[model samples]
Target: MTRDGAGLRVGDRPYRVFGCNTYYLMAWAADPNLRRHVDEVLDTAVQFGLNTVRTWAFNDGEDQWNALQPRPGEHDERVLEALDYVVWQAGRRGLRLILALVNHWDDYGGRRRYAAWSSTAKRADDFYRDAACRRCYRHHARTLVERTNSYTGRVYRDDPTILAWELGNEPRCARDPSGLTLQYWLEEMSAHLKELDPNHLVGTGLEGFWGKWREGRYNPPRWLGGQGSDFLWNHQPDTIDLMSFHVYPDHWHMDEKATMRWIREHLDAAAELGKPAVMGEFGKRGPRALRERCFRKWLDATTSAATDTEHPAAAGALFWALYHDDYPDYDRFGVYRRHESTVDLLRSYTAR
Candidate 1:
């Protein structure tokens, strides 16, 4: 995939990212009994006309489930093979993937784990500036990019199935309200990833916060000056090929109108920057009717933007998540195959 003007294209043909997030694919694929869940979700994606999927590619620390990197610079071959399986299977189904390299939170031993492994720093935010932590991150990234998929026999860097590599999941540095720390880190890491694999795109997995430098009245009160990221500044790095932001109106205390504004703000920014933007994650929790209403509104806003011939609109939007019957709806945001109404809504949107 490549960017042309404000939109994305594949070998001269236009491409839009209508997709869903399946963050647990790697873990489930590692378990023989649970691997079917991965297949089930992807099959559903195809059935719905969805073409892209976002998932976590990192699992650090020894205690984490299916920890891909149980130790710094070391990995469990079995788990890595499982990841390879995910890449192979997704490609087989003609689906593109956006793989996040790390997490900002500690759920899968993210920044906090890296900080612990490399220094005495107790705050997860310290991972951004620590030299040792940066080294470990680069190492892990190199391993993944250079990895030769056991199933496909193709190095990850050379694989066309990968749409992009996300820097981290919603990266932030609350300790530095100016957002310079996180900004610099993103610039450095994105440049490094590009040096390693110039064939693929790199993105900052940010939540679309406005930093002190770029704050405006359009921003939500909670993000008046950002949690520690400048959406525009963070994407200034030349190596950063794609712009990404996530939305959770319920969690952010935003109503439907505010949510649409937030998305439009990012799409406008992406157009100014000459890059394609994606609503990497978005969802609401409540009764089915309420969820459907919000989803329809949000999808309408994004899809409408895609039709703008004068300016580049959002490349596409992906819902909060996709899950199968085998898994519990742990987050309430999970959209299962049995939810025919919701499935139909997403399917219709993708078809558009």
Candidate 2:
């Protein structure tokens, strides 16, 4: 395990991280094609030195509206089935999977209106409000967590393949969740996870852009502090034992010097809280040359302590992907072609 200066200890590490941002779980529709690809991806990841994986547990609709009573947070069989296989596969290959419980897509796809939390207060208004959502939470949230806490909804909770339980993906998305509603939901969800999955750590997948206009602190944008100063930092979401961050080129592109400098700025921000934060999702999706250039630049800068302008805050780094995209759109972002590549320069630094 490696613990960067972030003060958060990454279990089972040699200081640097080697992982892949994956979507195999998303495509699993209880089909053989999906299962085959899942094994292929995991095997490839292991051979390429990948030690960790950041994968999602369920989609918004994995267990959506039930025509029946729908009591509390009952998940459909699809979620349980998919997770069982995912955990089993990861465990077999020695890969740790960090499962994100909720995400913004489809029903909760950061859309203007998507109600995952409902209320049953004396008044409709009260029930519709966040307070009401909080009130009815335990019944719904606990059911969802309890089902997944076990190896199978059909079995018991004793899987050693899980790395952490994340409350949601980028709960800070203003487009989908209102600040207050999302914050309250996150607090409730995090607390719910702690009770359900105490065996593993918990966190939220957050994107790093500390000095943004959305926050109330720093008009001129000097620095930040405390919980209320920023997005993820603003709310001390429950069950968050570790932190994850995402980064990409700006609107267009940034050179090596600019990219490394910006990384430093964010690392400095995370360092103050003295919490371990992983660069969970980061990479340039363009021509192969551009991608290679960026990775080489980042790797060179990170491997050498001199390039880090601030404290060594980031614990591990995982590229955006490791699979081959069949379509033209996917090719631009995929780090490998149909056959995949061991030349994934980022994987070279997993031993860090």
Candidate 3:
């Protein structure tokens, strides 16, 4: 279940991931009729030869729809059942998942909600250090991992359908630009997750930022937003099994050329640390052709490097998203099924 020199392995066979993100999977699965939508998405993933997926497993607070934890330590059985269906469905279809536990952003009222529930008006950074917030998160994590799946009649801790459990979605402590705070928080939470589910892998859902204190060979300029996290140092903990990073050149306003370099840094860090690494998220805007080219470059690099490099630790890349046709509310980053050329490109990589 751990990484060998080449990368992650199932026994002696190397398990290279051709994956994509479906952040709204659980949301879509909430309704029995809409559950088919989840299947369709997974269907496309399988058809494209993608063996893995990354999804949001946690939606906190009362206001968010399909909220997993409507209140601290309490869960909505209906929503949980929907997610149980997702896990079982993905497993039946032969797709493993990387389930993120929390979000840094407010899309699902993430860490901020935790702070609020703890009776504080503090920001996301405060959630890590706050005693009440940490306790709430600990309870939430425990409650989630221990819950037996109603649909599969199996405890989540025993499910192989889950590839890994992520600490959070792009966790960052902007207030503590030094990275020490985030590092401490990761140490505690990562260890806690391992104790809760030793059978599954754990990864910090970091965006591969190398904080000031622990920069290795490359130190990206601060303007590029490489502060508040030391990706390499962060993953060095005994509890973390995988190193994860995200790439969004268009959103970050970085040149397309920087994407490959960012990937190289993380891969190098993973290789050096003797752990597997994944580009868990990446996307771009503008014309479809440009996006296709960027994605193709990453796929090519990952696949080609597996054989060519002495230290092959790049597990694979997962594009930002894959939305079905007629899903409505399309975004620039989502690769809808109608985007035939891009879909073809993603499918081609899986064929590799």
Candidate 4:
């Protein structure tokens, strides 16, 4: 994919993403007994007309489930093969992927694990500043990018199936509210990834937080320059091809109006930067009726903005997650096959 001003293009045609985050693909594919589940989820994506799928490509530490890197600089070949399977299968189905290299959270032993591996680190955020932790991250990035998919026999960097390489999942450095720490980390990491694979796009998996440099009324009160992510400054790196931000109104204490405003603000910001923007993740949790209503509202807002002639439209929007019957609705944000109404809503939007 290539960036065309504020839009994205595949060859000469414009490409707008209609997709969902399915973070379990690699883990599911890794287990021989659970490989079928990965197929089931991807099949559902095709059924819904989604052209893209974003999932985790990183699992760290020895104790974590489906740990790809059991220890610093060490990988389990079996799990890596499973990830290869995911790339092959998704490519066969004509779905592009955004594979995140790490995470800011501890769910899959993210920065916390990296920090633990660093002798100079005292906190998770230290992973950004510590040389040892940064080295570990670079090693992982190289391993994955240079890998030749066992199933496809194509090096990951040469594979067109992978849409982009995300820097990390909602990367933040709360220890430095000025946002310079995370911004500098993103610049260094994105440049490194590009140096390894100039064929694909790189993104900062930020949650659209404003930094002290650009804080104002548009920011949520609780996030007024405190999350260590400046959506604007972070994307300034030339190697950063796409701008990404996630939305979770319920968790952020935002109502419907505030949520729409947040979306617009990010879209407008990306337009100003002359790069394509994607709502990489968004979701609502509650009664079935409320969830469906909110989903439709947000989808309409994003779609409408895409068609506007005055400014650049968002490249795409992906909901929080897509899950199958085999998995539990652990987050309450899961969109399952049984949710007929929600499925129809998403399907209809994708058709547009």
What's model 2's overall lDDT? 0.54
Q: Rank by TM-score, descending?
A: 4, 1, 3, 2
Instruction: State the C-alpha lDDT per candidate.
Output: 0.88, 0.54, 0.82, 0.90
Better of 2 and 4 by TM-score: 4
Candidate 4 residue lDDT tens string, 1-352: 8877778889998888889999989988999999999998999999878999999999999998889999999999999999999999999999999999999999888999999988899999999999999999999999999999999999999999999999999998989997879888999999999999999999888888887667463776665578788888888789998899888987888888999899888888887898888899999999989998988888887787676667766888899899988899999999888888888888899778
Please provide TM-scores, in order, for all candidate models, with all chains considered together: 0.97, 0.73, 0.95, 0.97
- Model 2 misplaced regions, further than 4 Å: 1-16, 62-72, 105-145, 148-158, 173-185, 211-232, 235-238, 250-257, 300-312, 324-331, 337-344
lDDT of 2 by residue, 1-352 (tens): 3233454344654334457777545445245556677777778778778878887654443343311112334445654565667777788898987776545444322111224434333322232234544444444435444554334333223455666666655544333223444455556667776777576666667654343445543212232221222444533554566666665764325555656776665555556665556677777765677777777766554455322445555556677777734323453556654433336554556545
- Evaluate model 1: give its lDDT: 0.88
Ranking by lDDT: 4, 1, 3, 2
What is the per-residue lDDT of model 3 for residues 1-352, given as tens digits with 9 covering 90 to 100?
5567548888778888778898888988997778888989999888767899899999998899889999987889999888898999999999999999899988887888888887764666788899988888888788779989998899999988988999999998878787788889999999999999998889898888777655354444554344577787789899998888888876666675666787777776777787878888988888888888888887787787665557787887788887766476366788776677876787788767
Cα deviation of 288, candidate 1, in Å = 1.5
lDDT of 1 at 346: 83
Q: What is the lDDT of residue 174 in candidate 1?
A: 87
Stretches > 4 Å off in candidate 4: 215-217
Off by over 4 Å in 1: 223-226
Indicate whether candidate 1 or candidate 3 has the larger TM-score. 1
